[model samples]
Target: MGVSIVDVAAQANVSTATVSRALRGLPRVSESTRAKVLATAQSLGYVASPSASGLASGRTRTVGVLVPFLDRWYFGHVIEGMDQVLRDNGYNLLLFSLGGYRHGKMRRFTESMVRKQIDALVVLTLGLSAEELRQLHRTDIPLLSVGGPVEGCSGVYIDDGAAATAAVEHLIALGHRRIGYLRAGIQDEKNFEVPALRTIAFETALAKAGLELRPAWCMVGDFTVAEGQRAAARIFDAPGEQPTAIFSGSDEMALGLIFEAQRRGIRIPAQLSVVGIDDHEFSASAGLTTVGQKPLEHGKTAAGMLLAELGGTPHSLRETLMPFELMVRDTTAPPPR
Candidate 1:
């Protein structure tokens, strides 16, 4: 045999258990003894088995991340942020997708697939119900949520309602009284819907400013570019009581609205002003005014919180709100007389 933990222990004049503990860098092992064991292990070319170490210590040094949808831009940015932070802290990520059915979500989570595999859990934009949360708590894994606040879980979230308020208020400040609100269609009504929050905020702001919240001005639909074009057509089809400003729930939808308006020979800001949430990658180049929330930072913060829980530091379980900024670009302005 080449070299083993036994050989390393013999060379270092320490117990095999001491050699094992030192190599794994587990707690309760003295620094001096660890240094000696590491030096001896290196000299003997002894490599510890990762699987055996994990099995013996009952720690996988991994975290489980559950997201509602992976294709969305915000979620992608959050995943990138979490990936970087987890790697920096010497932990691996195990991702789970809770797709389609509630039963499926429960089965996938409760099944042995992820059993004893992850030290902590982080859920992105998926608000867990009391029963679902209780089921998760049965795992005894620390949990965190992002995008929206959860009842009992430690979370990193943005004030999405407030961001929408800021975007609408900006357009109102530009003297655009006839405002239209575009929202996303509700897919998962039980989890969380941002458009509902945005709509409420938009209406609240308008009512606070003593402006009428018209039925004709409110439109709810998908976030697709095609939906944007369709909504724009519907809004401009009739000449009675036209809106001078539009507040879109997403940057992608805003872009579609902008292009559709241009096709109709409507001049942005001068003829029709537009405001959007999510300062997307092309928002600046497209000159789209938007509310900026750091999706990547949300991811990193959630990851950090999970790691802290895993390490037994026990951080606060309160909802942590990340900051938001307003990016005023060429898309919004005062309407013409």
Candidate 2:
């Protein structure tokens, strides 16, 4: 024998509607009445059924988060931040990890799978094509993005190009003229153009300083430690002048460069200064200098935006650019005379 709203209302000498509103924490119920209803419900061991409540209110109080890669540091950090914010506001998270091959998953998520599950959607580090976005828009799901720009959606993102420029500027300020860049060879199937933006920023900054943009000084590598290690070996062994500074697109790659460089007795920040983007956890532990983009903040903000829309609040549809900071550390210094 379970207590229902009727039992709570009768015990509190209140209407069933008042008991229901009090249990849901809606504003119309006075505090005194709410307390009475809560006390009655607790004494009778009455609990509100989320399934029944959802059927009545037409809201599940859940948010769906779609991320392209789960193993990467940036995506992981963002998810952690989003989880905290959503939980605090009485919303549950439904996470879907799109595999490394993101193209196929992206199409399916927007079309058949995610439409009915969540009240809102949060996408991370992924660029949905125009057509795909249009199809998602048709679902009328409140959408928010993190990590990159998305047209016709509210989002929070860091300027990847500016962050890249800041990393290069730090090395330049240290008087390292010959800088080598380790970057992704091409965009993956997610259609995210992060690598392209980094490349353009690197070249733009170098050109402004009257430095020659040498193709040889640039090496193509994926966002993996192994790829960075391989690229480091090729750069150090190539028949040309060794660069005094190395700017890696990611902290993972930068760590690989430092490891390989140390094994060969190459003194860090003396013979070679190294700088990386995304101040990941390992960056601090390794004392590696980096350009910091707050992925956690980005995720929290994106979740907040989606929640606002779900709450029937007015949410602006535009790119939200989060700021970046330069974290100076032991890895970067002036090249030796």
Candidate 3:
């Protein structure tokens, strides 16, 4: 027979109730006691069944994480941080991929979520519909968002508009008057606030710097290397004067643009300059200049907030903006004379 809670409680020198509370990560359990109980449980090979525990405490000890795309670097890193935190707290994570911004998929996911047993919900980079929001609100569970702000909910994210402005300002300061913007064009227009804010900030920065917004300089890509290559080719093949510098919405696209430019016999930082958001892992090696925010930190913060709420200390439903830095690399320089 498997080791039971009684064995763990006896080993930890605590009551069965206390052992249960500690194992479930409930509040009021001292850290030392919790650690001792966990150690004892581990040593005894004791594993509490989820169904039994949920029946006793009315909590599943699980959190549901909703993401747009699991393949993206940002989402993957954020999930890693969140999963670590959840495991540390003796909780489990249930991941639900919405398969991009498809309305039908979102509806189906929301409907399915209503049947699942979860203590909290975390949404990454995707906005919820009004009906879905109402459904989740009715559950009265802690809900957290990452990478973008949601109405009437608490979230952790960087200021997309400010970051975009800073990136464009860096190019402007380097004496680049003609600048291009490469933006992600996928996702439903209504739910795409992050890119919209960045686009607005880019235009605002250009206008504030007394530079005309050239229609030919704005290109839309699918936030992929191939799309970036295509955008770069279009800019180069155009009949008019090309922009001296380009700002991509993501580092992957920026790297792709650079690779494509090199393939066409164009020199980087000598004939063209590039800037992007998201300091992707390969961005450093590729020497792509970008505005960087810590996705892992965002995940940790969101998880902390949810745990706090679960522990009966609900935070205000205000959005928290994380910090960002402008990373100067070899790809960005002053416009060629």
**Most TM-score-accurate candidate:** 3
Please write out the lDDT profile of model 2 over residues 121-234, one tens digit for every residue: 777767666766776676555677788766676678888999999999988888888989998766542367677788889989888877777677678777778888888888
Report the lDDT of model 2 for residue 84: 91
Give a tens-digit lDDT track for model 1, residues 1-337: 6787788888999887567556654444677987888787777777666463532344677878777666777888988898899999888888888763445546344534454566667777776666666667665556788777665776787788899999999998989889997777665434565666777899899999998877676665566567877777777775688899999888878888888899999999899999989888878899999998889988888887766655545453457989999999999989879
Which pairs of residues clash in candidate 1, taking residues 3 or more apart in a chain or in different chains? none
**TM-score between model 3 and native:** 0.82
Q: Candidate 2: deviation at residue 309, Å?
A: 2.0
- Candidate 3 C-alpha lDDT tens digits along 107-164: 4445446333676788787777787676656544567888887766678899999999
- lDDT of all predictions: 0.76, 0.78, 0.81
Task: Output the better candidate (1/3) by lDDT.
Answer: 3
Q: How should the candidates be ordered by TM-score, best one leading? A: 3, 2, 1
Q: Which candidate's lDDT is highest?
A: 3
Q: If scored against the real structure, what TM-score would every candidate get?
A: 0.78, 0.80, 0.82
Q: What is the lDDT of residue 156 in candidate 3?
A: 88
TM-score of 2: 0.80
Stretches off by above 4 angstroms in model 3 are 1-55, 102-116, 186-189, 316-318
